[model samples]
Target: MLSSHCLNDDPWNKFPFTGFVAMISAVLTLMVDSITTSVFSRSGKEEPHADVASAYTPDQEMGRSHHGDHGLNLSDDKELGSTLQLLRYRVIAIVLELGIVVHSIVIGVSVGATNNTCTIKGLIAALCFHQMFEGMGLGGCILQAKYEWVKKAVMAFFFAVTTPFGVVLGMALSKTYKENSPDSLITVGLLNASSGGLLIYMSLVDLLAADFMGQKMQQSIKLQLKSYAAVLLGSGGMAVLAKWT
Candidate 1:
């Protein structure tokens, strides 16, 4: 197995295989829900209107026509919707970090399990920069959410210790660590696939979709172009980093 780590001989990676499987299952569930909602919404079909008149009141109708007319509108209804959306973004950010934490831990575990000084040197620097940028993104979302101090502190704590916790866990399991086993490959592949799905969904749905489909980005072709360029630059930089990882 001429793979990423020494061929099928490392057990440290295998130790987290069960956790990877569970996370993948959870991600798949969310992906399926997102897909179903998207498809159902696009068809403009809802369960046969159970008493349409009762469902939509005169005030509701007026709100739909007026308040919901524009994303930028400052009506009570629109404000509520926007507030909910902002909260949703923060929740997604928190969950995204949770998913990211799993991988981060695995990376830490690998680093801790190894005695290679050269690898450790690069890992420390790369990880520091990676965490910094990820924190910036998460912080922006949190600031927008306007959560209470305690909640913010809890989220921050989770992000701060995730990798270190993984490192410590890996150190504990180093005795059983075998990095190149067949089990490890399947596990890593699945974890990567799961994380990839969650990230893609969050990026497209919560972040890009909300803004890109909103009045602001939709109205400005130049802004849209610049945003696309920015996404490309960020993605390209991450891809380059993968070469080293």
Candidate 2:
């Protein structure tokens, strides 16, 4: 006998376990983050600069013959290097999208569960900012991937639609959903844990590590310091937001 009055009367009651679920999500995320870092570091090797250089084609001008054929030789390292960059970019983009979609769906579910105006308003603001930054990151990856227009459209659609889909699902289930119930706790906890782990893995390993260890950052002491500071600031801001939403 689910009734609309049930939510209005027991709003706070569903919250305790929901809060626990969120925290569980956060903790599981941290553990997955740690393990991914460890595994990647262990398996990584100190690649030689010459090997790195060989991955790329020789400069087009340098390789150009007097006959003016500027096409990179199939055997040229530069062509291979460019191909590798393209591969890396596409893989990272897909992984990043997966993480973002997870976070978005969870937030959408939270919104669907609530009749509280205050919560929704705060979430809207945070989510707008979140989507903007995430879009920038994913857009860069997509551009680098150089997907054809159709494939690009499809990926974009998938990223853009996930939140709204979650909202629809949540709305449909709102009557039966109880965020604080023991069953709800276990369900949300495990879901959040999995999503959080995926996010942390993508953020630290797929994104941050790649940038930090890249040659450009390694060579620039000043940029390196600034980037780290920016990371701290971003992480701190997200942490503060967690307090409210």
User: Which prediction has the highest TM-score against the true structure?
Assistant: 2
lDDT (C-alpha) at residue 71 in model 2 = 50
**Model 2, range 1-245, lDDT digits (tens) per residue?**
11222333464354554445545655655565456544433333232132233333457435533333455454345544554555556666776777778877877776777677897888877878777888888888788767777778988998899888877877877889876665555555556656666666667766799899999999999999999999999989877776777
For model 2, state the Cα shift of residue 79 in Å. Answer: 1.5
Cα lDDT of model 1 by residue, 1-245, tens digit:
22346435465345555455555656774775466445533332342222123334579767655753456445644444444454455556666666667667766776776667887887787788777877886777666655666777887888889889878876787677655555655565566556655666666666678778999899999999999999899888777776676
lDDT of 1 at 150: 76
TM-scores of all candidate predictions against the true structure: 0.66, 0.69
lDDT of each: 0.64, 0.67
- For model 1, the stretches where C-alpha displacement exceeds 4 angstroms are 1-76
